[model samples]
Structure formats: structure tokens, C-alpha cells
Target: MSSDAPVDARAPGQKTFFGHPRALSTLFLTEMWERFSFYGMRAILVLYLTASVAEDGLGISESTANAVYGTYNAMVYLMALPGGWVADRLLGARRSVLWGGVVIAAGHYVMAIPARWSVFAGMTLIVLGTGLLKPNISTMVGGLYDRDSPRRDAGFSIFYMGINLGAFIAPLITGFLGEKVNWHLGFGAAAIGMTFGVLQYVLGRRNLGDTGDRPADPLLGADRRRALTRIGVAVLVLLLVLAVLAVADLFTVNTVVNSLTIATVVITIGYFARIITDREISSTERSRMKAYLWLFVFAAAFWLIYDQAGSVLNLFAADRTDRDVLGFTFPASWLQSVNPILIIIGAPLAALLWLRLGHRVSTPVKFAVGLVLNGLSFVLMAAAAQAAVGGDLVSPWWLVAVYAIQVAGELSLSPVGLSATTKLAPVKYASQMMGLWFLATAVGDAVGGQVARLAETWPEPTYFLAFGLASVALGLGAVMFTRHISRLMAGIH
Candidate 1:
């Protein structure tokens, strides 16, 4: 999504291999395999961290594991800004993606070696690699289709399907091995998955053509030196901060988690303030940006609810949900796949439904619907949690239903929000605005992690119900403001 490339409907000469562009296929499969590694590692990270050392895990506390998960996920998105900057200034998306792939595979493999030092080191590498890969690759995908091309939305959907395909299968394989066989095996599987993505990417680089080969604004000699120096300074400062924190006995899980949460929020506010006050945009553009700011709010809320799948709900599935289906127990990591599987099945149908009725469905209305659906999912989970308060395991269907509802919610908010983001972004700061959109996710995920950390402290029913009610209330509030937000959108729908 980090792209400021001008829309060109110029016929892609010699590029009509998929009823659109051959590059879309290459990008799609690369991202699919990339996501396979990502989601595969994610599916078991918290579980591995919190499991007993006897089980080949780190034996961290549940709260610590959840916090680490939250912070890791948060950094993954927050780094996209600098990663996109690197591409826009020096590396270009293709090289960034390639290097990112290398780092990602290395990270997974490191974690596969099974040691105390490897855990944090591997996570840091994945975070950096993901930061480099995610936004730029998404920008490349957007670059593949012209703005006016009808295939643009469809292309993203197809691309998204590839992502889900990876997500859907990753857990079935990695989850089984990680949870049942060995955690290191699962991590290694994730590495292998990324290896496939990298090999395929190299083979198909020609298909990518010159889409993300050049910078929108190339840096001059002085600018290049200053940028590199700044990166070095930033790295030094970060190391110093870590050293200070260690000296103070404050380099703990909560410190890192809370600091990141604050950082995400501050960055979000700064981005919105900058975009809204920019003189380069027209009044209409400014107003649309403001509307986007609201979308950011709703989006953060949605993700805060959604991201619990990896932390709170993951733990629930492991300990609280009955996976015994006719005496055949399934791995808890398999629970992560249910959402992507549903998304794979439901995304196309949702796309079709939107194509048929998009004219009538306002963006805010879609966001409102998404919020309501999200709340409903938590409501279902809350009921299950209530039923299980007496030390009974809830039926697995409760989780399935939660994921199914969330799939609907995610379909509405995520895709619509992505389109709305690019549409509403100020042209001068388009890539940064994309980074801002993901900042909302960073905030949500960080906050969700904090909430998950508290899960053990609160009664299951109360925790679920409180968050569920909050979501429903926010949804209703958005519905009430739909017309106002639409007016501010300045002709974008």
C-alpha cells in the first residue's frame, strides 16, 4: 500500500497473460508463500513462548508471551514506513522484497534451531524483513493494475486469495508439526515455505517488469548521504536506549510492549495532523483525509478485536475449547487457519456482492457493518466463555462461529479500508499515508496484546463481554455518523 505512483491506464504491451498482467501472478504467489511463513510462525509463537520448557518452549509466562506477540506484530507494521522509505529512496521494491525474503527465511531458520538467544534474534529479523516486504510488495501489487482498470479490485481479491491460501494451509501443516511434533520443526517448515516464495520470485522477476524499479522521487547526492547517516544514527540511538533500559532493570516485556503501543499511537496522531494540515491538498482532499482519519479509528477498533485471534483466542483454543471431534483431537494452531479458510471461501462471494451493490453501499456503512459483525463474533465467544466458567471446555463450534463472523467483518473493513485509504490519501504523502493506515493496525494489535495479557486476570465471560459491548457500541456510533463521514469523503465512495 505504500505507493504514490500515478495511475497509468497505458496499455501494458506484451503483459496480458492473466486477462490482466502476468506480474500479478508472480506477486500473488510470492506473497502467498511469504504469508505462509508469516502466519505459520505467528500461529505458534505465543504457544511456543508460554509452553513448558520440557515441551521445548521458552517457558515464559502467558502474559509475557502475549506481550511479546503483540509487540512483535506491532513492530512488523510500524517498520513498514522506513522500509517503504528505503524502497522509495534506494533499494526499489524488487530488491527490498528480495532482501526481505532472505531475512525472513533466515529468521525462521534461526528460530528452528531451538535456543534461548535464537528466539528474540529470529523475531527481530522477521520483523525487519516483514517491514521491508509487506508495504512495498503491496505497493507493487497496486502498481500492477491501472487506476481505472476494472480489474484493479478483482486483482487485489485474487491476490488476497493467494494470501489466504497460504494462511489456510500453513497452520494445518506448521501448526501440526509445531504443536504436536516439535516447535522447531514448525519454525523450520515456515522457513521452507518462505524459501519457495523466494525461489519462485527469482524465477519470475522478469514478469515484474519495471513496475517498482524506479523511485517516484530520486534522492540527490547530499540527500543520499544524509539518509544513510540518519539510519545509522537511529540504529545507534536504539541500541543506546536498550542499553539504558537494561541498566535500569526496565528492559522487561511490559516496557517494550507499552513503549511500542505508545509509539504507534503517537505516530498515528502525527500522520493525521500532518496530512490534514498540508497546504498541498485541496479542501476536498483535506476533508477526505479527515474522513479517512475516522476510518482509521474504526479500523483500529476492528483490528484490536480481530488480532485477539493470535493471543487470547489462541490460548482459549488451546486450553478452553474442546478440540476432540469424535475422539480425534486437532492442534490448537489449526484454529488459526479457520479464519483464512473462511476468507478464501467468502472473499470472492463478498467481492461479487460488492460489485453488484457497491453503488448503494457507502464506505462508512460498510465499516459500520464490519464493526457490528466483529462485535457479534466476540458476543458468540463471550457466550462460550460464560458456559465454560465452571471449568468446562466450550464446544469448538463457538470458535468456528467466531472466526466465521470475523471473516465477514474483516472482508468489509480491510478491503474497503484499503481502497478508501488510497483514494483519500493526499497525493504528496501517498506512501506515508499507506504507512499511516497500517499504523492503525499497529495500534490495534499492540492494544489487543495488552488486553490479551490481562485475560488471565479477568473472568473469561467478563473480558469477552466488555470488549464485545464496546465493539457493538462503536459500530452503532459509526452507523450514526455514516452520513456525516460520507459528506466529508468528497465524492469518494
Candidate 2:
């Protein structure tokens, strides 16, 4: 839920869904379809990029395509910072979500048009729309329950299920249409999913009571005018810069991606500096922020490998994995579903394990566990790549096992990292710390995309093995400093 949004009293005799707010069902379906559109497009993005031009594909080089995928993911996460601001100060969460869904639907519809430029244009729109929609909707979910309600965590758990469910189902639908039939048709399917989400969200608003009905902090007349003017000027300046780059013949896709990647890293560093140097915060708060920096590095490292599943591993599934079952071959993108399904199955079990263990395990230790497991996943992938080196297709089970390991790593670190971010944040920078946490992902994806370029020049097995070992070494190093990080945490679990 939004930190600034006012929580309102529930209406008397309000209807409930499974003893929770009736509005949860609405938000649940909204997020489900949004993710359906997102993952559905993602599952086939690289495959579509590298497919033969004769098959109506882009035919871009594999390394460039992988970089494009990474950069796109980075932009989506990066935008969330501005997205949250728009909701808090201008449109409010409800309107931001509504408009965001509309734009996302429009993006998918644009992709469904079979022109060469539509793909890039559609992706740009999707990135902007997702930025607006993603964070605010989660904030709205938080608004549904009081800060101290026991049901709050459970509500988020149910919401988490919605996310994984969409991810698990999207590739099966979109992958089949994109690979076996027309790619545009698959994109059309995603557009339809988001449309359903928007329609349902609109119709279900009555159940929401006062949630996100207005901005948390609306600007006054003169201030609003000034803010709007500044926004316009900023947009114009950005456009002018792009035009200059284009005129200079420096506006190629790779150039844009490289610029954005560098910008993401620079912004992350600046944000950290701004927070840690703030005179408003206490020494203890500063110490916690210092510890958070280490966890941020670890989180970035983890995502650098985990997110490659859609690019490097997707290509592997297509080219090297034998997907034949009972004489029927499957779409390679279907393999993307494996990770989400495993996440769905493992999440409850993980929660149980953590509950049973409680604070006996420290945050840094769990992070080490995650990093080591993530590294082991890639180490296993090295063996799979080696098996395919002789032009033999390896069994599909190799990819399944790989996703299982990655999911375990995700369960160990991702939620724990979010919890740690909240616990360690200075009071002055509490909400902003969440944005910093997301920046970790943006940084990882940006750097990882650049790193992926080496795959084109290096042997596949060597690429996997080297990174795998590096991550393992980082994990072991984190273990060595666990005591120090715990002390820096200053009573935070």
C-alpha cells in the first residue's frame, strides 16, 4: 500500500471475499492479467528477435537481442521511481493504475500490428505503462489492510500467488501462438488479457471504498502549474537530446541501451549518496544504510544471473534442449513457465521453513544461501551446455532442474531482501528506500545485459562456469562477514 495514501474505514456490512476485502479479488485479477501480458510478451521476445527474417522476424544478432531484452527489463523497473511519484502527487494510485493498464493494452495492440517499427514502439509504450502501473497497484493492496492487521501479510501472500499464476500460464498461451502461428496473434492475446484487467478494475471500484480516490499529496494551483511546466521542459529536453543523437548517427539500438545502462548505474550511486549523506538521519541509521549497501550489491549480483532465464536460458531451451514428448515437440517459450510453477509450489514450503526457524537465521546468511544456490544453478547449466556442444540435444529436464534451483534462490533472497530494506531504512528515507531496492534490479539487469555480450565470443560452457564460480566466491565472502552485517543491522532481524 502507498505510504502516503490515507487508509479509510470500511463501510458497514461490506461484502468480503474469503473473509478479506472484496476489493482484493479485483486487484488480484488486475495484477494477474497485467503480468500475463508482461511475461507473455517476454517469453517470446528474444526468440522473435533472432528468428529468420523470412519468417517475419527481426533477425537481430543473438547478443544484441539479449542486450535489448535486459535493457527493456531494466527500464521497466527503473521507471517505478517516477511512477510512484506520479501516483502520490498527481493522479493517485487508482487513476494511475487505470491509465497504466490502458497504455499497456495499447502497447500490446501496437505490437500486434506487423510493421517493423511497431515492435520497438510497442515495447517503449509497455515500459512506460508498466512503470506507472506496477508499483502503485502493490501500494493499493497495502491500503486495503490496516498497518497492524495480521491479515496484511496473508493478503500479500495471496497477491503473490496471482503474480506467479499469470507468469505460469502466459507462455503456454502466447508461446504457442507466437512460435507455431503468427507472432502478432500472440501479442494480440496479451493485449486482450490486459483489457480484461482494465475492464474488471473499473467495474469493481465500488468495493474499494475511499482507497486511492485522490492523490496522497496533491499540489496546489501555482505549485501544480510550475511542476507541470518543469515536466514539459524535461520531456522536451530528452527529446532534443535523442534527436541530436539521431542526427549524429549515434541513435542505434545498442547505443541507446548502453547509454541507459550507464545512466542506471550512475543514478543508483547518486541515490545512495543522497541518503547516506543526509544530515537529517542519525549515526545508527547511517550504519544500517551502510549494511544495506552490501545487501544491495548481493541482490544485484543475484538478479544478474536469475533474470538471464528469459534470454540466455530461453535460447538454450530452443536450440539445445530436446522438447520432444510422445513424438510431439513443444514451443521453447513454454519452458519459461517452469520457473513460476516451481515458485508457486515452493513459496509456501519456504514460508513454513522460515517461520519455523524464525530469527535463528540472519538476513546476510539467507542472502549467502541464495547467492550460493543461484551459483550452483549456473554451475549445473555449464554441464548442460557441455552436453550440447557436440550437436546433441539435451533432455528438457535439464532446464527444469535449472529453474527449480533458481526459484529456490529467489524464495530465499527476494522477499527477505524486501523485508530487510524496510527494517534498515532511516525514518526520513523510508519510502525512498523501496525505490532503492528496485534500483538494485535495474542495475543488475543493465550490467548483466552488457556482460551477456561476451557470450557471443566465449564458449558457452566457459561463460556459465566462470560466472557460476564468481557468484559462489561472492556468497562465501558474504558468509565471512555475516557477523559484521548483523551488528550493523542494529537489532533488525
Candidate 3:
């Protein structure tokens, strides 16, 4: 078992990273730079899509851009399912992370090439690479400590800080370059960041020891061959489908985005159905999974409204927010930094608040709180939109306020959901349960992308008000069902 692996992959006299394993430093830095690249690119994606072709932008409609953004996010999360499987069965976490980083760096470099087709091509590669890297890195981090070690939680907390730190810094650098200089130059910066992460990861492999040196559950000869064949067929089928679409003149962005959206929905429904109907799981486990279904819905709904930060909200910042600071206008993407910065500042505070509340608050109640706060943020956005009427630009503080509220909501729900997934997961499907959690986000982002088309068609205030109230109503409904969901949790806190 991985628990038996060396926690400190260093000579006895060697230094440690803040008294934890030296390996923590390696994984931490890898994750940080990876996040830097990811968020840096995301900060400017929609802006680039909607900018004039004369200005070296894609010239896509805002609605199409939003859908593209949503679909892109959906795919990134969705790939984690197979990504984990590959780590467990084929490449092992170490190789998977290494290759994933290589692919990710390549993707960013491709995006830096300034060709129209390169953006989409690069995004596809990035999604595939991210899927492989993201989940496995966390797994390796977990391998560092025993299951019940107190240091395990502290280690993850430190790792979480790395994520937010990278996110906080990315937009400042990339936004300036992309908005002020060339969009491709900004993407090139992201490429450089990932390349740094990859190089350092390789150099720091000595610290990793044998943490993820081999597969958790490696497939053997015949089975491995079958799996590889299946993967090959899947890829072939996908390419063939694209070829057919192009030949039929139906390979438009909208067509592909809509199709992927529908597929996400179907995959989610099928995933749930397969698990719930499984003969291997016990009745008690089935009941718990049933409760998880509700949580999944709540999580999906929460992300639907929350993830709009990059698309609808980013556009609002660009077009409707007054960015003038003593006649120097800041890039709209700079606002993307607000969420991570707030999270970094508020995460500890939220942890303390939850510690004080303890079991009295209940998971469902906390989720309800998250939903309400998320909705309230959007409700405030409606007011901001109203203020921007008559071709007037509102203060940038409006967005800062919105992101602050959303961060509060995120701090309340995200960590709690991850904890709950681990607690409520069926023993037989433990790892896959994490995949299901990621799917909840995928479903939300995919659907939210389709929903965002309304932002372009409807009045901004009405659009914000309707969705805001809907989330509030869902939160209230969650409040009403708390006791029932609690019972279904079957003693899980």
C-alpha cells in the first residue's frame, strides 16, 4: 500500500520543506506553476475571442465565446475521470504527471503560435493534459502521509495555498501582456510558465522517491492490451466524427460545443445510473449514494452561477466597468485575480469559523449557505448592471464586491464537498467518487455555457436577476430539505 512508502524522500540529514517531506516542495511548486499557466490563459480567453479581428482577436460573438468557454471548462474537468484511471492502470502517477505536463506545455506553445486554428487545437491538448496531471498530483500528495496523520491535513492546506498563490499572480502578468501587447504573447508566457513547472518537476524527482513510481492497480498483459485498443478506437472514432462533420459542413464551433454539452449531460446521467444500480454495493451504501445525488445537484447548480466569472462577468468588466485609475485603464483580466486573493485571505478565516461551529451547522446547511451567498452575489451584479445602463461604465469595485461574495460562498462549499465525497463514498468506488465530484462541476460549466447565451440576448439586469433569484430559491429549498438529507447521510457529519 502507498501508506508504506517513504514519506520523506530524503537522506536522514537532508533538509525538509517546512518540516514536512522535501517532496511536498516539489509537488507544491509543480502545482503552482501549472495553475499559473491555466489561470493566466483563462484570464484572457474570452477577451481574445470577442476582440476585433483587426485587433488580432477571434471576432466571435459574445454568446459563442461564452459557450466556448463553458464547454472548454467542462472538458477540462471531465477528463479527470479517465485521467485517474490511466494513473491507476497504466502510466502510474509519476509518468502521467510528467507526460501531462509535457502535453500541457506543448498546448500553450501551440496557442502562442497566433494561428486561428491553433487556439482550439491548443485548448484540446491542454484539456487532455490537465486531465492527466491535476488529479494524479493530488493523489501523490496524499501518498506522503499515513491515512490518519494530522500532518496530512496540514500538508494539503499548504498545497492549497500554492494553488491560490499562483492564481493570484497569473492575471497580473498575463493580463498586462495580453491586453497591452499581443494576445499570443500572453499565451506564450503561459507556455513558459508550464515549461518551467515541467523542468523543475523533472529536476525535483529525487524528492518524490517512490510515491507514485508504479500504478496503484496496474493492468496486466491481456487486459492492458485490451484497454490500449479501446483507447485507440475511441480516438479514431472521435477523429472520424470530426471528419464527417467537416465533410458535411457542420463542423462549426457552435455545433461542436452544443454536442459536447449534450454528451456531458448524458454521461452524468449514465454515471449516476450505473453506480446506483450496481449489484456490488450494499443497501446502506446505495442510500448514501442517493444522498450524494442531491449534493451533486446542489454542487452543479452552485457552479453554474459561480463559474460565470470568466465569461459573462469578464465581458462585463471589459465593457461596463470603469477601469480608469488616474487615467490609466487596467486590463479587465486583472479582476480575475480578485477571487484567488480573497480565497487566500479568507480560507483560514472560514476554516476557523467552521471549526467553531463544528457538527452543529450540518453539511446541508453549509451548502445552503453557499447557495444563498452565490445567488446574492449575482443579485448584487444586477444592481451593477443597472448602474451601467445608458452606455455608462460602473466602478470596478462592483466586480470586486461580486467576487468577494462568491469567494465566501466557495470557501463555505468547495472544501466541505470534497470532505463529504471522501466520507460518503462507497468503498468499492472510492476513487471514482472523486471523479463524480469533478463531474458535478463539468455538468455545471457545460450547462452554464448554454445558459450564458441568454446574457447576450436578454437585458443584462434581467439576466442577472433571474439567475440570482433562482439560486436563492434553490438554497432555500436546500434549507427545507436539510433534515431529510441529513437522515439520508446515515450518520455522516
Candidate 4:
């Protein structure tokens, strides 16, 4: 392996214990606290919106709250395109992350103010802040390791654990404070968490060194300019369309659907145009890119189900669950902790299981397993939903079980798909390729909100059943196409 890009500026012959670098610790803590704030606030958002006006909530209708929740979450991921571009092109990842953290902290503090306007402003800032922070941070994590280092996967798994750890604890603490006392207090707590994250990242600068330093190569400049131009033009067109819709009073469901449809068409055309115009890409590389695009479609299905934990599941717990355990009733918001808790417990074991099953199982096979497991989790939830019909409460254990199974699926797919992205992406367009990957996630989150709103009209069992069956079918389809994808991934190993 080449030593061209040294992650940590350590002296020669210095030992890294447990096959990982020291800087991992700093990044770990930084991400942990960041996720702590994000998830903590997320756990309470929908519940706070839908709570009675007498309880100090805005008393927004359930569907509207879900729409806002979904749109906010979607925009958070969508903004990463610009965030990643800015970091890779001009600001560098380290500075972008720091600025992002500051913005996020400010956003949370805005939410802490006791006013509706403040809440809206805070959410807007948070969405933009997350766009800046989230993708850049992950890129920094990758920068911490040398390319082709065997420890890369292990390091990412460890980083993923840090994410879940914060997620696990945030809701428990924040939910308690919000439900038992004041909602603003919970938001304030999240602000404090982000503040700590910012402090830690700032203090640990030496550990990061120049890993996210700007590229010295001149060729990157042209790439950056082209990407920016494309994005700017797209945004301008979108804004104009939205402006026209607003003026015409067409900013309704049909308008949203049309906007999304047009966005999809534009993205499709843009990708194909890149393939035609870029002479650097080989036929084989183009084939691999096509496969990756398909994987993005599959991933959208997975997130459409998984991202509902904050919106629909939170509401389900508040309205339907028997929250009492032992003698005391737990806050409904705390149910958001279930998936993270399961991730914390199940991730390492799942990694070990995959390693043991390695050689016997292909990556595509594992992906299929993940999809099936995710579907089964929804099936289990569907059963629970049926049992809980007619306003009767169901056992909390059912929710726990569902989350556990879903986490199992997440463990199988999330890390693996990230690894696969680098393997399959064309080297020249890597950042944009990753942007598309995140765009799929954004679409899924937005759709998840729409799916959750269906519960208002349809039986919960029907919603779960439909999601479960679609996931399973998608998984099976991926399995059937495994050979083609494997061929695309030929050089990765």
C-alpha cells in the first residue's frame, strides 16, 4: 500500500493499538455528541407538534406535522450535496464541520426559545446545518485511514457505534425532561449537546491534522467549477418553478408530487449526460456506475421504512402503547431509543457474524438478508398493530422486538453499502456519486413521512403489511440480480 496520504501526523514506528489510529477517539466523541443532539430533538419533534394546544403545542394537524417532519428530514440530507461540494472544493472538511456544528448549536438554541416563529427558524437552521455537518463528518472519518487499510471497515463500525451510543442515551434523558417538565428544556439540552460536540472538535484539531486539507492538484478546480454550475442552475430552475406554483396557489399535494417527479427526471438526465460527456470513464466503469444507481433505488426502500421511527413510531407509542414499566410510565418520546439501543447491542455481533459467514456469503447476499430482515420486522409490527386495534394497548416488548430485527437489517446493509460505493464509483466523479447515494436517503425519508401519514386513514396493519411485502420483494429482486452487480464489483476485491 502507498503512504502518500498519511492521516495522522504521527512519527515513524509509533504503534496504533487495536489496529486503529488514535484520532479515531476524537472523531468518535465529536460524532457521538452531534448525533446526541440531533436524535434527541428528533425524538420529540412530531410529538411536540401534535400535542394539544393546551399543552403548549401549536396543535398542527397530524398530517401537517408529519409533512413538516418529513420535509425537514429530507432537506437535511438533500443539503449535503452543497455541503460536500463546498468542503471538497473550497472550505475543506474540517472547517466546514466546525461551521456546521456552530450553525446546528444555534439552531437548537433557537428551538429552545418559547415561540412558534423561533421553532420554524430553528428547524430551518438545523436542516441547513445538518447539510453542512453530516456528510463532511463522514468524509473526515474516511480520511482518518489510509486507502486500502484493512482496518477501515472496523474503524467505520466503531464510528457507527459512537453514533448509536449517543442516539441510545439522548432520547432517554431528553424525552424525560421534555415530557416530565418543559418541552423547551429538552430542546435546550440538545443545544448543550451540540455545544459540547463543537468544543471537542475544536480542541482536538491536532489529532485531525491535515486529513481534510484542500487538494493541491489543479484538475480538481475545473471539476469543482463544473459541479457548482450544474447545481446552481438546477436550484435556480427549481426555485422559479416553486415561485410560480406559490403565485398560482398550486403549492398543494399535486404540486409536491409534480416537483418530485421533475426532480427525478432532471437527476436522471443529468447522470446520463455526465456519462456521455465524460471521456475519462470506461465502458466497464459506466456499467458499474449503473449498478450503483440501482443499489441507490433499493436503498431508498430500506430508508422509507427505517426513517419512520421518529414520526409514525413516535406517534404510535404516544397514542397506543402501554408505556408503564415496573411502576412508572415512560415518556412516549423515549420509544425512539429502541432502534439505537438495538444498534448498539447488535452491531458488533452482527459484524462478527458477517465475518464468520464471509466467503460463504457474498455482499449481495448479505444485502438481500438485510432487506428480508427489515421486511420481517415490519411484518412483526403489522401483527402488533392488528393486536392493538380498537384502542387496546399492546406490550412494549413488541416494539423492542421490531426495532431489534430492523437493526439487524441495518447492520447488514448500511456499512456494506458505503464500502460498496467507493468500490463501484468512478474515481473522477466520486463526490457526486456519493451525493446521489445520500439523495436516495433523502427521498426515502421524505417518502417515509408520506407513508406514515397513511396511518391516519388506513389501518396500521395495512401500512405495515404493504411496507413489509415491498421490502421483501425488493430484497428478492436484488438477490436475483446479484450476478450482474457482482460483475460490476469485480475489481473491488
Go through the candidates in order and give the clash count of each. 0, 2, 0, 0
Summarize candidate 2's per-residue lDDT along 1-493 as a digit string, tens digits.
Answer: 5433433335577777667788888999999999999999999999998898998899988899989999999999999999888888899888999999999999999999998889889999999999899998998998888888888899899999999999999999999999999988899999999999999999998867678777888887998999899999999999999999999999999999999999999999999999999999999999999999999999999999999999999999999999889898999999999999999999999999999999999999999999999999999999999999988999989989989998999999999999999999999888778888989999989899888877778889999999988998999999999999988888888
- Sort by lDDT, best first: what order? 3, 2, 1, 4
Please give the lDDT score for candidate 4: 0.79
lDDT of 1 by residue, 403-434 (tens): 99999999988988987888898778776778
Task: Give the Cα error of residue 488 in candidate 2, in Å.
Answer: 1.5
Give the worst 10-residue stretch by lDDT in candidate 4: 1-10
User: lDDT of each model, Cα atoms only?
Assistant: 0.87, 0.91, 0.94, 0.79
The sequence of per-residue lDDT tens digits that candidate 3 reaches over residues 347-416 is: 9999999999999999998899999999999999999999998999999999999999999999899999
lDDT of 4 by residue, 140-224 (tens): 8888777777777788888888898999899998899888888889999999999999998889776665767563222266776
Candidate 2: regions farther than 4 A off: 1-12
What TM-score, computed on C-alpha atoms, does each candidate reach? 0.94, 0.98, 0.99, 0.88
Error of 4 at 473 (Å): 2.2
Best model number under TM-score: 3
